[model samples]
Each structure stands twice: as C-alpha cells, then as structure tokens.
Target: MKKLLLSLVLLISFLGNSQILDPVKWKTKVVQKSDTEFELVMDATIDDEWHMYSQFTPDGGALPSVFEYKNTKGNYTLVGKTKESPYKKVFNDIFEVDEYYFAKTAQFKQVIKVTNPKLKEVKVYVEYQACKEQCIQQDKTFTFKLPEIKATEKGEEVIKEEPKEEIVPTEIASNDIDSTSIKTEKVTETKATTETNKTEVSNEPVEEEKKGLWSIFVLAFLGGFAALLTPCVFPMIPMTVSFFTKQSKTKAIGIRNAIIYGFSIIVIYLLLGILVSLIFGADALNALSTNVWFNIIFFVLLIVFAASFLGAFEIMLPNKWANKVDSQADRGGLLGIFFMALALAIVSFSCTGPIVGTLLVQAAAGGSQIGPIVGMFGFSLAIALPFALFAAFPGWMNSLPKSGGWLNTVKVSLGFLELALAFKFLSNADLVLQAHWLEREVFLAIWIVIFGAWAVYLFGKITLPHDSPLSHISVGRLFLALLVSIFTVYLIPGLWGAPLKLISGFPPPMTYSESPNGVGYKNQGIVGATATLPEHAHFSEHGIVAFHDYDKGLAYAKEVGKPVLLDFTGYACVNCRKMEQNVWSKPEILPLLKDEFVLISLYVDAKEELPKEEQYVSPETGKEIVTVGNKWSDFQITRYKNNAQPYYIILDDNGKDLTEQVGYTPDVEEYQAWLDKGLKAFKK
Candidate 1:
C-alpha cells in the first residue's frame, strides 16, 4: 500500500512539471524624447523554466545578457540596467529557484538619443539565455526605425520633444564647492513640489505600527506560552502545589501559595528584561542590525546551540550556585519561594537553555523598545501556567506524562533545527555582500546532508554517545524516518540542474551555481538560441557572480543611460511582495518602463561597500554612511525623510530628482496616480 501511494505521488509531481514550462513571448513600445530621439521598448517573455542574466557576471559565471544596436544610423545610449518583476515560491533544502514570468510576455526598453532628429531608421541586437533541464542560448537582431507621421495643424500630432534637458552627468563631484548651493536649492525645490502635489487625496489611511497597552499584552501572552514547556517549571508544578496542600493543611492555603509562585516567576523574568533594556539601551538593537561582527557572532552562537542539542555537553550554571538559591525556600516567606524558583531556573538551564536562547535571540533581533519585556513575559507565562492549573486541580497531575527518552529526543531535534536556522543568517550575510560560495544549491546541499544524517540518527542507525539505546522502533517512528529519507532524495535532482521550485528566491539564485549554464549545451550552438545544443553545462564554464554593492551598480548605471529603480526592501518585508505583484503588472505601467527609467533595486538588507569617496557622516544624525545600501538609505531618509517602503522615485540624466518620491501606495488607483505624478514631473 505504501509503495502504491509513493508511485501515485511521484506521477502527480511529474505532471505538474510537464505543464508550466517557460513561454517565450515578446512586446515593445516607443517613447519620443525629442524630434531627433525616440526610445524603443521591447519585452521578452521566456517560458517558466528559464532566466536571463544581468550584464555583469564574475569569472566562470553566466554572461550578462548582452545588447548592441544593429541596423541603425542613429546614436543610441545604453541604459543603466534591465528591470525584472519579482517572483515567489517556497524555498527548500535544494537551494534553487524556478524563474517565472508574466504568462506570455516580457519587456525590454532602449532609449535612442539621435544626433539627427530627422533620422528614420535604427536597429537593435540582443543576446540572452533560456533553459529547461537544458539551456538554449540565442541571439536575435531586429530593425525598429519609426514610420513617418505628417504634422497636424492643431498640434494634435505635432510632437515636439520638449528637450527638457536634465544635468545628469555620468558622475557627480561630492566636493563640488557648489554642492552646498545645490543642496539648498534641492531642498527648496523638493518642498515646493510636495506642497503643489498635496491636494488631500482620498485613500484609506494605513494603520501605523501598533503601540501601547495591547501590544504589551500580546507580547506577554506569547512569552507565557513559551515558558510552559521548560523543564524547571513543568515538573515542579505538581510538586509545589502538593507540598503547599499538605503542609498548609488546607486547599485554600495551597491555592494561595501556588498563585504567589506564579507571580514570583513573572517578577523575576520581568526584572531580567528590565536589566537587559538598561544595559543595552534602546538604540543598541538598531546598531546591531548593521554591525557585521554581531551577525557573525550570532551565527557562531547558533552553532553552539546546535552542538549542545547534539549532546556535546550539558550547558548549565554550577550546582553549588543554584543550590545556594534553592536553600532559601526553607526561610518560610514569599521571597524565599521566589529565590527557590530562580534556583530551579539556574539548575535546569541545561534542559531549558535552547528555548531561552531562542527567545533572547528573537528579542534582540526584534530590537523594539519593549522587546526584552515581551520576551520575558512569554517565558514567565509558560513557567507560571502549570503551577496555577495544577494547584487549581490537584488530580490532573495523575494524567501528566512522565519524563522519558522522548524528552531527550525533543531536545536533540530542536538542536538540529537551530543548526539549520543558523545557516539562514549565514546565507543572509553571504547574499548581502554578494558572496558567491553560498549559492542556493550549495546551501541546500549542506542542509539536506545535515537533515538526512539527523533522520538516520533518529532511527538509531546513527547514535550519539549520550543517546538512549533503541531496542526496537515503533511503527510511527519508522514512518517518520521514511518520510524524511524521501524528502532528502528529492534534493538530489537540484545538483543536476533542477529549480526545486519549493524554495524559490529564499535561497540564493541558481545563477550562483558552480556551473549554471546548460551542462551539455556549452560552446556548441547559437548563443541565446532556439536551436538544440550540447548539454554538460560544466561548473568551470559557468558560474554566477553575485553583486550586492549599490555604488558599483550606480557606476555601471552611469557607464551604461539606464534610469535607476530603487527597491528599498527588507528580508522580512511582506509588503514588498504585495507591491511587486499588485502594482508592477499594469500594461501601461510596464511599457513606459524603458523610455523614462533605469531600474535599480536596492535591498535595504544587502551588505556591500560604499565607495570611500562617496561615504560621509550625516550632519542631521551624525551616522556614518557605512555600506553601499546605507548610502542609498541615507539619501532616502534624509531627502524623502521616510524609511518605510516600498518607495519609488525617478531621477533625470544628472542623477538629480526629476520627480516626487512616493511611499507605500497599496491602492491600484493611488499607485497609478502616484506614478502619473512622477511621469508629469519628469516631463516638466
């Protein structure tokens, strides 16, 4: 029966892949810049299983899709970069992504700055890659010279390119003594634009990030739940309540002690939260976010957490130290009982340490003013719950399960999970700086091997020194082991060039693979072609070079007339996805892309260099513009003065503001209005 079920599942999987193959479709649009200059916008849609590369790949990686104007007499200026709409899919252990496109269409745009406005003919050449299991590289050339149109007397078609020249040069001098003069002018102009644009537009006001009493209550609720499972708290619930019942010689007195015990746990945990807040100060969390060493240290700490779970060693405070507190319970007062609880926490740290570590890490990462307090609330609630419940109903203790080897198993499993979670942070570090080694596939390979070994260990095929002997396994255990083994097998296809669609962009893009090109198709067919080719897409021949630096991209943008599209995104920003899907899809919006804009996506979470010359200290806040993203972020914060995303703006040829900046427009109508405002501003 099991074999039959497996076969049925495999068949369904094959059918899903057979459909949704990448579809190659293309479209174009024309935007008039002047009587002599017109922009050509062509969009290409490749089938589901393929992707085109950017212009800059490191050594041994896929070539950046190349473009050359062909069959043209007009002077054409290359734009900064091509823009792609974002895609989404679940990320998994395979470390690869399936590049999806708009069903049957993709778009590309080119701006032509003609030396002679009267010229009627021009040509374009493009080279790119498209693939399934095998990639077919292709090159195509097309001539798209404009057809003549007679002028209308009423100025209906008397299109005069306003030649609204912008001072956007390929470079800006940071210390151009006139920079101060420019700054004053820039600020005044920005304020005038904002005032003119404000007409009290009607839209639903977004709820601000929640604050006040309810937020605190919610944090407390979550903390209490986490504490319930701690070894120190669960077992002691019945013991403490039973002792109170017997010694006090009355149910009421016992109930009173139990209530007091729960309150003591809360107080102690809250104090810890308070102390952390005092020591770190409110701004420490924000500072840590950008501090590279903190991230590295976190990575190492999680590794230690994983090892401890694997039974490398018990992590606990000294017994004498804990015993000193435990001994205070004999003093017959509320403070003594509270000390006893603290002693229990210290002594049982070996068992409870992972949970505490995880909570603290989460708190630190959240970096909210009340983060520690919220975290402590969750911990104390979990610890306090059982005491209240057991005291209220003494008979329920009979139903509680006794501690056994399964408890140890739970600890080890969590350790494995922590180890896995650690890599995500590492991956974040790698991708932020565009480190190529931690490609999606490589990350997956490590995870698959680790989890596979864990499965084997779970089944007793591999045993830790401290593990309990397994005389025999239950059917349930065998079934779980089988499930994990099958999942591991699923990752193997990725090494041989599978997208592993389950975990798409969450992993590093497959463009980072050792040999991402068609394994057999290398060196034998038309580049970016429809023709079949040899398929051994070897690693040495094809690798993906990661580029995370914005300054570098900006330099490339200037080197190449591509307008820059700034995408201020976060690793955890859900709204970023909403903007990508909801707004970037309209037909009018997609086509106007090339004539007026160069797309530059700046992920706020990315880590990379800021050119030393470009870096500076912000006068307003005195913060260093440390990374490439930081420079852009500083610009966004100081100029627009808003950090919340998804923000959009358009700049002219001189990299000066050509439009009003818009932030977080979720409504389609509002988005269109916002975009239109920018377009008009650019035109003016």
Candidate 2:
C-alpha cells in the first residue's frame, strides 16, 4: 500500500512538471506610407485554447500587448497604437461569474512615421508572452521597407491631412489617401504624405519564449518555506509528528506518517492552485493588478489584516464551526490525516491568517496564472516539513526554543511590519488625489512614534492584553531596545529639516512638500493630515495640475522651451526608493532634475479616483477610474503600452516620442547613457 501511494504521488508530480505551452502560428505585413513612412502589422493564429491580452488592459495587470519597431531612421509612431480583435469568455469570481474576450485572429498594427526620406528600410521588432493551461512566450521581429511611390508628374505639392485624420488611424481606409497626390508629390514640397504601401506578409509560426522553469520552481519553493513560519502552520509541526510517533510505536512508522503529512500539504496546496487557475484564468491576472476596484479591495483587506495583527481585533473562523471540522480528524486513515491537517490549519487561523492573506495577495497581484498555486504550495511545504523531519531525527527537536515571551515579541514585530505596509496603500490613494505635502518626513514621524511606544512597552513602561511584564531585563534585550529607541529619536530632526534619503521613494514626491529649504523632495514618504493643494496649483482638486498630465507636461515644456522629462513611477515600488537615494541624491543627478528638464513625475500606483461624474470605466477591462494616480497609471499602460514602474519616457512638444527606459538600471554610466539618449532624441 505504501509503495502504491508513493508511485501515485511520483506520477502526479511528473505530470505537473511536464506541462508545456501549445503551438502557435504567427504572420506579419507592412503597409507603407512612402519611402520614409509605413505601418507594420503582426497577426497570431492562437490555438483554440489560448488568447493574448489587448492593448488597453488595467494598469498593474498583464503586460500590455506591445509592438517593438526596429531599424527605423526617423521615428516609429504606433499610429494611435496597436489594437487586438475582440472576443467573449466566461469569468468565475468568488461572488459572481461573467464572460469576456477580444475577437479571433488578433491583429497588432503600428504606423511608423519617418524623417530623412533618404533612409531606407525599417525592421519592426515584436515581443509577447501568451498563456493557456500552461504559458509560453516568444520574441519575434518583422522587417520591411516602405516601397517608393512612383511619381505621375514632377514638382507637385503635397498637402497635410486634417489633424483629426490621424485619430483612430486603423479605421481610416487605404483609399482615403490622395492617390492623385502620390504621383505628383516632391520630397521638399511634401507638406504631409499618406502613402498606402502594402507589402505581402507571410505569417510565421513561432514557439514561445522558453523561461528558466527551474527559477520559477525555486521561487515557488522559497514561497512555501516562508509560509511555514506563519503562526498557522508552525505549531502543527510538533503536534503532527507527536501524533504519528505515538501511533506508530516505532521510529520507521513515525517517519512514514511524517512523510505523509508533508505529502498531504503538497496535495492541498496543488488543489488550491487548480481552483485559482480555473476561476481567474491566466489573462485576468493582469487586470487584478491594475484594476482600481481591485486595488481598493486589496487595500481594505490589508488594512483589516494589519489591524488584526496590531491587536485591534482577532479574525478567525467560528469556534463551533471549526471544532466540528477538527472533530473529524481522529478516524485513523488517510482521510483522517488530511482532516487532521485541516484542523491544525483552522486552529492557528489567528496567527497565520495575516501572513497567508499577505502572501496570497502578493501572489495574485503578480498576474501570473500559476502564482497563487505556487505561492500556496510554498507556504504549505514550509508548514508541513518539520513534522517529517523531526520524526526522522527526533533528538533534534530538543534543541528548539520553547514558546514564551519571544513568541509575543515575534507577533509584535510582525504587527509593526503590517502597520508599515498599510501606509503604502494609503499613500497610493493620497498621491492620486494630488494631496501633496505627505513627504518622507511625515512617514518617518509616524514610524518613530510607533516604534518608540513599542520600545517603552518592551521595557514594562506599558502592557497590552496579550503581553506579560518583564521581571528582569536581559543585557542583550536592553541593548537592542535602547538602540531602537535611539533610532526613533534620530528621526525627529526630519520634521524641521533633514534629508531623510534612506526612504525617499517610499513617500510621495518631494515636490508635494512645503519644506522651508529649497531642497526638492521625491513625491514619497509623508502625507499631510488635512487635504489641501499648493496655493499656485492650476488643477481642480481631482484634475492633474499644469505640467502634471502628459499633454499638459508637453505643453508646458513647449511654453518654457524646455525639453520634456516623463517620469513613470509607482507608490509601492521598492527599487524606485533605492534609485532616489542612490542616484537622484548624487549631486550631479540632483542639479539636472532641478534645472535641466521640465519634470513630470507621473505616479503609476496612485489609487484615488476622479468624482463619479468625471470617472470613466474602461470598456476593455470593466474597471473604473477612481483616483488621480489611477488616471495617469491607466494612461501610461493603455497609451504608452508599458506597465513596469520607474520607467522614464522623454517626449517633445506635439507629443513626439523622445526616449523611454523602464525599470531600474543601477550603473551610473548606464543611467548617464539614457540621459544622453533622451537629450539627443529630443534634439532630433
């Protein structure tokens, strides 16, 4: 029986690991405008089971369907950008089920406008990731040329179309362009030329990009390990092992039971994964990340969790209800063991609930179909393992520390972390509302108070319902508490004037603050208690200020005759914080930001929305625009077709693209290279 069970488990594991992406056939085409301009289109014949994301998804969700046009001379304008065919599919949520999809044979097209008509041929490069039951992605490029238009007569003038003609470029027919003008047009006299240069495109079938499956596996493993430390699972290690050891009456039998416990954990976690994948689907993960309502929901949930951690309340399953389930674990079979595990899980809800909630939230927010499953599995494995290991080497259990005051200390530390994390969500809302002045100093002020109170409590200056008095202070504990208290005091200087650079990115942008000194602050850290705007603000309370929105930023730059600097940033991103401290603080970078370019720091993680009258819901994703940050974040994702934060896009007046670099590049030289690239792109 044992051998049979082991073989079955092994087979299931093999099947899970063997999952792969389905085959997809792809094709490309070029619609030329003249010798210098053209539109490039890529089409994918997705298998019946698979579908790709559309261009306008909710920010923070899936990667926006992107078109990377390479080998062009002047510039590749996406001609109002790429659009996917529409479709409909069913969605099953915990509360309700709905259906959604874009059309079949999704066509992604981009129009590339060029300068220096002498420059020949352009290569359109495209990269995308598609997933079904399993996920596989590919990076492919399409290269084509603008076929030169043959002139019917010499020295004819070309007339530019109405500005409105460029809007919705895809809907415009090829015949709409002046066929008579192409023949007579001369290069120098060309006011604006529209040439429909259609190049026959062969659809190339391609495979998905092969990811380092091992890396994903390892990350999943670490996630499981972290889950075990949560209050819910840790206590079970000893109890489960003891139960098996007592029943087995032999070391070998005990070891086998422990192994079964671990296997049970894996099975439970995998089942949860299957359910999530089935319900959310792979593509919807993207929407969850950027959807304003979803963000709001996440914020509320985290607040509840944080409050519970802080001893404001305890969240748990009903006692009579949980006890009924626990009663079933003593039947003495495989089912009984499973029930036993469930009982253990239910009992530890108070301690483990917050951690599990946090992990699950993070995993879901990642927008990977497999994320929740992998995350749960990691958590369960951590919770499951000590039982088996202790059974195998029972003597090792003696070395473990007893649960006492230290356990309460651990809980308090975690509470601190939870309270700290809650501010980030709040900050997200604050930034979107244009509630500036909540800079890093404000964040520090609150933290110092929280920690100071905590230190006092540890020293028996205060006590909570769950805490005990310290009879005698250990030297080590005294030293640690003293150090923390001193650190708390250290933050006070920041209230008046201090460069708290260590956590610059964690707060709102520095421009929001009214710090007496001229030293600029990143829009991070502290938030003001009362809602108010700067006296010179041009924005309505909800609308973006002058030089805040993209169009406005470009206009301001044009008015000032300064080059435009577009900052794609987020409220929750940790790397952005590091960049502000390490690079932005560098004397060289600081001066450049203050004087060289017109800075437009767009916050991609802001959660406040416009009033109901002004708020717009996205037709593509069925999510509302609730906050100021949400508007800009959505604009960046849907318009620019990029989601990664800490992205920098440089543009000129008339909304011309200059340079765009995403994510953090640590090397100073690499950053400098981007700086130079943007300066040159603007010049062009």
Candidate 3:
C-alpha cells in the first residue's frame, strides 16, 4: 500500500512536467552615440496570449523585468535610469496585486557613458518573467564595446564604432529574486541557471499540486460514503425518497426533484469549501502544514470531535436553524427541494460535521488554495449520489440494511480512529518545535492502546453509548476484530524502533526517537568498520550518520572525499517523512544514502530559534529572520527558486549543483538512477 501511494506521487510528478512556456522574445541593440557614449536598446515582442511585467511592477508574486550592468563604478557612468515603454496596468486575482505589464511589443533603453579608455567591452543582462495561463522566467546577455578614438600627431581624430545588434538565446532565471529593480551598481552575480531544458510552460509543479488535490478528493469521497452509513443519514435516504415519491404528481417529477435536492446538497458543501478557502487565502495555506500553533489547535479540535463521536456528548447545530430550514422544505417547489437539502445538512451535523471539518483541515494543509473545494466536491458527490439514485429507482430501497446498533458501532469505531489521529497533529507540533514531548516509542505506545482497545470492543468485550446489548460477535464484527488485532500486533515492534512502513506519515520520524537505533540495540546499517562521528552529527534510524548543520556536513564530506547530498526536509512534512520511511529505508537505496554521500538533512520547518547575534533582517522580504528553519528556507528559495520539501540535490566538492535538483522522488529505480547520474558526474 505504501509503495502504491508513492508510485501515485511519482506518476503525478512526471505528469506535472508540463511543457515550458516562453512567451516573450528579446533582442538587444547597441546604438553607438560617440567614442564614450552608447544607448543599449532592448526590444521585447510578446506572444499573443502572454504578457511581460515591467520593472516597476509591485511586489506580490509576479516577476518584473530587471537589468544588471556589471562592474559599473570605475568603468562607466549611467546617463539616466533604464527607460521602459508604457505598459498596461491590470489586477491579478491570484496574487491580488496591481501588475504593470506589456503586451504585443515593448522597448527599454539604458544610456551609458564609458569612462575607462582601455576597456573594450561591457556585459549586460536582462531577465524578464512573462505569464499567460502560467509564468516563465527568461534572461538574455548583451555586450557593448568602446568606440574607437584615433589620435593624430597634433590632435585626436575619432573613428567611431558601428552599431551592433544581439538577438535571442536569452537565458532564463530559475532562482527567485523578490520585487523588481534595474541595478546601477553590481550586487552579487549569480550563475545563469535554467530549471529545465524544455522550451514550453514548465508547470510540472502545478500538476504535482493537483496530485495532492486528487488524493484529497479520493479520501473525501470515501469519507462521504462512510457518512452515508451513519445513523443520522442512512434512514433519511429511505424516508426522503418516500416523501418525494408520495408528494409529486408523477414518478418523473419525483425523480427530478430528488436529483435537484442532491445537487443542492452538493452546492451547500461546495460553498463551505469556498468559505474555508476565502478565510485562509493562498499564502496562509502553505504555513498550515507546519505551523506549531495551528497544529496544536487542530489537535485540540480533533480531540473534541473524537470525544463527541465516542458518545460522551452530541455535537449539533442550533435547533432554530434546522427548524427554519425544515419549514422551508414544506413550500412545495424547486426552492422547497433546495431547502430540503439544506435541512438534511443541518440535521445531520453531529455525524457529518466532524468528518467535513477533518477533510477541510487535511485539504488546506496540502498548500493548494483550491484543495478544499475539490475535497468538498468529492465528499458531497458521494453523499448526493445515493439520494438521487434511490429516488430514481424506488425498488432498490429494500436492499439497504436496517439502521440499528451497527450505525453506532461505526461511529464508535471512528471515534477510536479519531483518537489515534488526534495525536498525529500533536506529534506534528512536537516535531516542528523539537519539543521531544512525543517521540517514536511513545507514539507507537499510544497507537497500540487505541487500536488494541478498539479490537477488544469489536469482539464484544466492551460497550459504549448507543450500543445494543450483545450476546456474541457477528461474523462481520469478528472479521474486523481479527484485522484490528493483526494491526495492533503489527505496531508492537515499532516501540523497539520499527520503521512501521504501513503507517509511515502518521508518527514522528525515526530521527526523533528515544533511541536512534532500536530500543536496546544499535543499528547494523553503520560501521562495516568503526566510523568516528562528525561534529553536529547524530545517528538516524538504520544507523546512517547525518549532520543537521549544512557547513559541517559539507566539510565532513570534503574530508571523507565524498559527494554531498543536501536533503531539504521538514519535521512536519508528511511526504518528507514518507520518503524517509519507505524510500530511503529500502535495501537498494539505504547503502547509497549511508555510504556514498555525506547526508545533510536540513529541516526547513524546524522551529528552533537562532542566536541573537546570528539573527538578521532579510533584504528581499524585509522580515526578521529569527529561527534556523527560516534561514534555511530563505537559502532554499534564494538559491533554488523551488520551495517544496523533501527536495534533494547532489553536489561535488564545491557547492555547485552536480545535476538538476529534484523534489519528492519516490521510485527506487528512478531515484537510484538520479543518484548514479550524480555519482558519475562527480567522477568526471
């Protein structure tokens, strides 16, 4: 099952490698004014569907065109700032900013006066980002030479330089630079790097994001089906269908009304998703996954929901709201059918509300703004289908099992699962804060109790609220008891430091444990010979020694004559943990991770505070950087342009990339091939 999910993740990543978009073409013309003066003219012709932002575009998300003239102070003097053609001002919905951009054609001019007599050429580069359905970063380099001035015996006579033009093959930017500005003075020169060789829209990240939404949809759909079997909804299916059949003039009208009712139910849930998206917004969604406070709140919220599900007390909407919606259902028309759907939602809040709330939280944590909407659509569809189908074919109504003790049994079982899931959020917070409150063994112990007790309950050993008195376990109940027992047994070894691949993403990582090795034994993955530990290093699970500090890891790799494998991971990153448990622990890959590379695991979400002297303000975002995680996160965005976790990069002795960096690779063969490629490059 773990392998299957990883394969799904990889498949989505490959599909996400969409064609790269290059919507703007750049051409540079150097107009020679005299021996010392030149006007660098740059023209951009944009594609019909796309637009390029000007340098003055405000900070939001869009990239603006920027020009950098290298080594300028002693060599040349700027006559004025770079001038750009008038552009269109438009509002961008996604970033919510007033973007200044140009369509069709645009021109920019920079006038420079040469000061150095011996200087022959000056290099200039311009990088501009253009967007249509998606955005792409592109850049081009140009050089201007000093015009000739020949001296006669008595006086100086000038033979002027001719105007020269340089066309496209302009390099594009892969890394991020906050805001837009034309530099008169040189800051730091970066390597001209491209993210991919593909010359179309490289929106593979977008598709990978969709993969997460797809998973949420599937989970939510399953949740909806579970909601249908609960006490609040299952009986309503029969009674609601019966009302439609008896009240309508004909069977056709009855079926139509029922369909409308289901659609209205769908709309109601969709609106709830929309409301969630609006409240959180896109930027906040990114932080929801790893934020300590949010995780703690979610932990508390799920605990309350679990307690409600366990028959301690009921969770319900206000009685007045349901009463009002129920009254509207009696109006007898399309409006009445819609109100009937609204009433169902209000009435079934106790059972379905927790499930809906959980789904939304999970979806929002995916960092995709549209995730909740997609999840709610799937959830509502699963619920809505039954009402419409049953009304259309009234004869099928006899097939459903009679609502009884089994419904409450389902609810109680969910309560147990919820109790276990609640700890996962707490664990997320613990991992991020590195609080050491919930380590590996303690987490497994909690699950052991939760699942073990649930198994006992299934076998008729205990009773809870709404449970009918039982003499013996039913066949189905007995089967579920056996499965839960097997799973509970499976968790026992986890206390002694098992990977627990089956529940990889739920628990704390193997690194955050009472013992990095097993409970009493050291891992055998290390020390074919005795290996001395490096500074800032610790033994992770599988006895693979790793460094938490980047400089230490890289320095150790240099001393050991090995390549550096930079793992930009996160403590609360679900997929990051999944890769560690399932992919990194594999027999074929474990040796490579252990032996070939000096592994540096930089936790981007680590919440440890940096020292006061080390802390400084970021020039780009102007935010005060106070923590180690925030510093590394900035390093990643500034150096790589990508910001997703479980990001991997292989480097030689120096810090340059050996190959293109990759995000969240799960396939063993594919990942091994990438490792091999890096090894081969390092050898060269």
| Cα distance off (Å), candidate 2, residue 331 | 1.7
Q: Rank by TM-score, highest first.
A: 3, 2, 1
The worst-scoring run of ten residues by lDDT in candidate 3 lies at 190-199
Residue-level lDDT tens digits of model 1 in 184-235: 1233443353343222211212121123223444655654453344343456
Runs of candidate 3 with Cα error greater than 4 angstroms are 1-180, 183-202, 523-684
Residue lDDT tens for model 3, 67-179: 99977879888886786655554544323333566777777778788788766666776766665533444455556544443332221212233423322234322222121
The stretch of ten residues in a row with the least summed lDDT in candidate 1 is 175-184
**What lDDT is reached at residue 233 by model 1?**
43
Please rank every candidate by lDDT, starting with the best.
Answer: 3, 2, 1
6-42: candidate 2 lDDT, tens digit per residue: 4464345334433223334555445445544455545
Q: Identify the superior model by TM-score, candidate 1 or candidate 2.
A: 2
Instruction: State how far residue 340 of model 1 sits from its true place (Å).
Output: 2.2
lDDT of 1 at 155: 12
TM-score of each: 0.48, 0.49, 0.57
Query: What do the candidate models score in CA lDDT, each in turn?
Result: 0.53, 0.54, 0.73
Residue 627 lDDT in model 1? 72
